[model samples]
Target: NWRSRIVFLLKTNSSKPMLHLIGNRPSADAVNQWAESLDKLLNGTTVFSIFLKSEFCKENIEFWTACEDFKMLTSRKARASKASNIYEEFIKSEAPQEINLDLHIRNDIIENLQEPATTSFLAAQVKIYSLMENNSYPRFIHSNLYKKLCAAARQEVKYNKS
Candidate 1:
């Protein structure tokens, strides 16, 4: 499973489920759920990142999630390699989608990279997670993108029974 968790930073699971919720806890079926609610708008979803594909900050959620997954890895070897890759792609100043983080956090990650622990990105992950939990998650709930998808799902359900 460490192998799966390692490169997880590089891959996106499109089949990941989307949840339309307004509370911290999810239904029995929520594939991946958030820890808390989103300003009375939405809860969370693993696939919510895809909904943000066209947005400039879309990488925030997914990158945060990837770091979380990477932390869960049981292999130190896997953590060593994945840590640097995630930092290179999402945390570095010149990265394609550099995440906003404190200078201290960046320094800590660089130091951690030398020994690469499972929690190397913990601080950065927390910031990204908060950014999404407070900002993007709420905005996404009100976005037409989610509304249209919900409407289509309802229509499909109705048509299926017809």
Candidate 2:
């Protein structure tokens, strides 16, 4: 039922089937179906959707203004949130084995807080943390602060043992 509904919606304007592609347009199935015929056409449709949306948004100031409003919408919010998880995966892979990710993120926020241009982005982060903590703090201790505290704790441990 769902597949048929999707097929119907996609075919409403054109009789051609829309290939929902991610990565590459001419997938194995499309290539197998026509080999060379549908390749260019399918790729063109995907490219058109992307470039057309960008141009349309730029042409209409109302559409540009709606970027934030659209983000509040379920579809846009889901897409936006996916980017952060992708970034987190990259961070985990690139960071040193012993580095604490939570502390790393916090430290990055603190570093950004020092810059006036980035104040708004940092403010959003602080508000989220504040919500999690369930109380207000005089200042947000970012990842760098956490690292320094951990280092100090280690030094204390070493001194006590000696």
Instruction: TM-score each candidate.
Output: 0.66, 0.16
Give one digit per residue, the lDDT tens place, for model 2 in 71-127.
344553444453243233222345221112365554553353323231312333333
Task: Itemize residue pairs with steric clashes in candidate 1.
Answer: none
Question: Pairing residues by index, what is the TM-score of model 1?
Answer: 0.66
Error of 2 at 120 (Å): 31
The top-ranked prediction according to lDDT is 1
TM-score top scorer: 1
Per-candidate alpha-carbon RMSD to the true structure: 9.4, 25.9
- What tens-digit string does per-residue lDDT give for candidate 1 at 1-162? 322321242243434323222224223333222213542233344336554554568788768767877978887888888887888888889998788999999999988887887778888888887887777777766655444445445554566679
